[model samples]
Target chain A: MTERFERELMRGSLDLMVLSVLADGANYGYLIQKRVRDAGGDMIKLQAGTLYPLLHRLEADGVIKSKWDHSTGRKRKWYELTPAGRRRIRDQALQWDKYAACIQRILTPALAALPAK
Target chain B: MTERFERELMRGSLDLMVLSVLADGANYGYLIQKRVRDAGGDMIKLQAGTLYPLLHRLEADGVIKSKWDHSTGRKRKWYELTPAGRRRIRDQALQWDKYAACIQRILTPALAALPAK
Candidate 1:
């Protein structure tokens, strides 16, 4: 896929990706976006507009918490997963595994079924 | 977890969950919410306030397309994944698997490491 297309697709799945990244340590918005892009290779990148809204929403939902940090010369909002957030990422990961397996089952056709009955 | 807490956690992961749910077939908002709750086994439920915004955002992003259906007595918005969305869910699923594996690595400790060298 083109980088643009990949970016858009990535936007749809940003929350889980963000939580997973923050699972490592606290990070500010730009750094998180950069990490996702770097980690995703050339396939995905996140726009600030999309990323900020998701970060704000996650904070509002209490999955992740943010605080202003002034250690970096200029103040920046840094985010980290709350205890609730950590558990949430774990639960969502489990759910995603089950859901993906179910979808694969539906999508996969038995080889025997390929021939006319 | 309480149903309420599960619902909130589910909110954080709703987009991927929604696309996975819709992969089965097109469905209206209420039915989709019901299916998620039923499939999730009391672990997840979607609220309209949250669901509507997500649906609208997905529509805006061209991941899922929606239409108003009037056949069910009341007008309800129904959604289905676009081809782009299908590809997106697939990519995101693959990325999530890798991300999960990495996190698990960070979390797991070598048994020998428990004792100081």
Candidate 2:
């Protein structure tokens, strides 16, 4: 796997990615991981170990709240975004956009100077 | 402190904030902590306990490489961004912008609908 993809996936920014997914509605940990993998295509795959810690962190921060559910005849934590969490999702999304644009501007010249494919 | 500021300062995303400061040049941990506080203009102050782990993680990820320097007769770990580190910094800055923008767009309406302050 390319370093870019690995760096992005491993950097633990997955909290925002997971929050984006949960923004739609509630989801269990396994399903959230699956959704990130599916959404990111083959380029990014989130591991369970990373996902759970992030979920707990988000919950601890009160950005996202969770409750135990027995939907599958086994207990699982179902997470959903709270109003605060929703606001955060929006704020973080905006921050990411501006950040991406600045980086793109910086990279454009470098990319242009690269040898042709 | 407002939840917005606290939330931003916490959640351990201090990594990026630190990287942004170090982008100028190599700096020791204590100086970095001081710089972030000074740069943030009292809005954000990075604690040493939180700062060290983030520095270590960044070093571990190879986004930043560090060396111990003896200055003022005391040893300190000084960190500088690597080429790969620079690239990741740029990428992350971009991602944060995009995330922030989308959030701002969503919040505009909500802010507008709020009663006048």
Candidate 3:
């Protein structure tokens, strides 16, 4: 099996991934972690340390909002996209697509030019 | 035009892009920078600061080797890939494809789920 993409490759797009998941609905940290994991199909695993900092950063950046909920009988913090975050999702997603396409252009010919494996 | 991807997005894939350019033939720093810029269609501009350090690192990694040529009378440093560098290109390219696919899976549906702009 091909090795997973190195962490650096995933770092740039991670905010987009989490924002995308929230587009489906509001979620707490654990669910966000699971969704990213499941969406990447074994390529992504958002650790708590990574996820919380990212979530906090996004909140601090005004892209997301969080609130405490005790309605579930235990206090849990839920996160949802703000208007800025929705726009961020749109913006970052577009940028990510373009970047991926550029990579494809370089990679395809480079691979073709290689002596066949 | 959409804004160029932020530096972080480009940073992760920088090595792959340079290696791809080198795969075409032995090249000096300026040409590698030019090829990446042209191929990215204005999305990439591999500044000398970024390019040289990366070249040195790749050289240190033993994936690429460089030689000084005075035949041009400019004492240019030319670089070419080693066998390991070629192998790195293949492995990185495949991983990038899978990772891009994963992003697509999450992004497409997430975009769909958004309220119409």
Candidate 4:
């Protein structure tokens, strides 16, 4: 990725991406990181430093809820989307679609102006 | 668009979007804003307050150049992508494609996991 695009991509959308992982089900931090990394084919890495703070902010905002899980013989904090978070992810996904479509339209006006094939 | 998505979208991408407008040809500030607005179908608004500073930054970064136009009996500043700007846009567009594709994979792992139809 270009340096500018990489910098801007991280600055903008990390939170929503993390929330998306949690949308599937409750997940611990390590797993959450892995899930996002694997899902993006490692193109987008969510470091612990970035992930934890965002998770905290989302929890504090009541978008997600977390609880300790000792089922694996070790303490882990598992997180899941709250009702608000589910709603938030749904809304964010829609907005992303709209925004992306708009950008695509702007970027390819010549193509957009063409009659549908 | 959701507020978070809008805020993040502007934070991350206004530069490239502007660069894209200039990528087509040199244009004055008003026309730059108009092209972007019209391109996005008004979903993405680039207020003058946000656009001029970004244009100046790109200029300072040497990605774009500007000069006064007086052929119409009024002074106007026209901006165009420098050679560096063209290369930058090309690189940025490729990065955006990769990053967006990565995000799509992460966002819809379920669909991605499905076998080819």
Q: Which one is best on lDDT?
A: 3
- Docking quality tier of model 1: incorrect
For candidate 4, lDDT tens digit of each residue in B1-117? 365567677665777788887766678899999988887764677789988898899999999999998888878999987778777766666676777787776667532332333
RMSD each, Å = 8.1, 7.4, 2.3, 4.9
For residues A1-117, could you state the per-residue lDDT of candidate 1 as single tens digits? 334334443432457678877877889999999987776554555679888998999999898999998887888999998878777766665655554454334233321122231
Q: Model 1 segments beyond 4 Å from truth?
A: A1-12, A110-117, B1-117
TM-score of predicted chain A against the true chain A, for each candidate: 0.80, 0.88, 0.93, 0.83
Tell me each candidate's TM-score.
0.49, 0.52, 0.93, 0.85
Lowest summed lDDT window (length 10), candidate 1 chain A? A108-117
Candidate 1's DockQ is 0.09
* Candidate 4 off by > 4 Å: A70-74, A109-117, B70-74, B110-117
In model 1, how large is the Cα lDDT of residue B30? 88
For candidate 3, the lDDT comes to 0.87
Q: What is the lDDT of residue B33 in candidate 4?
A: 90
Give the lowest summed-lDDT range of ten residues in model 4 chain A.
Answer: A108-117
Q: Calculate DockQ per candidate and list them.
A: 0.09, 0.08, 0.67, 0.38
Best by DockQ: 3
For candidate 1, what is the TM-score? 0.49
DockQ, cand. 2: 0.08
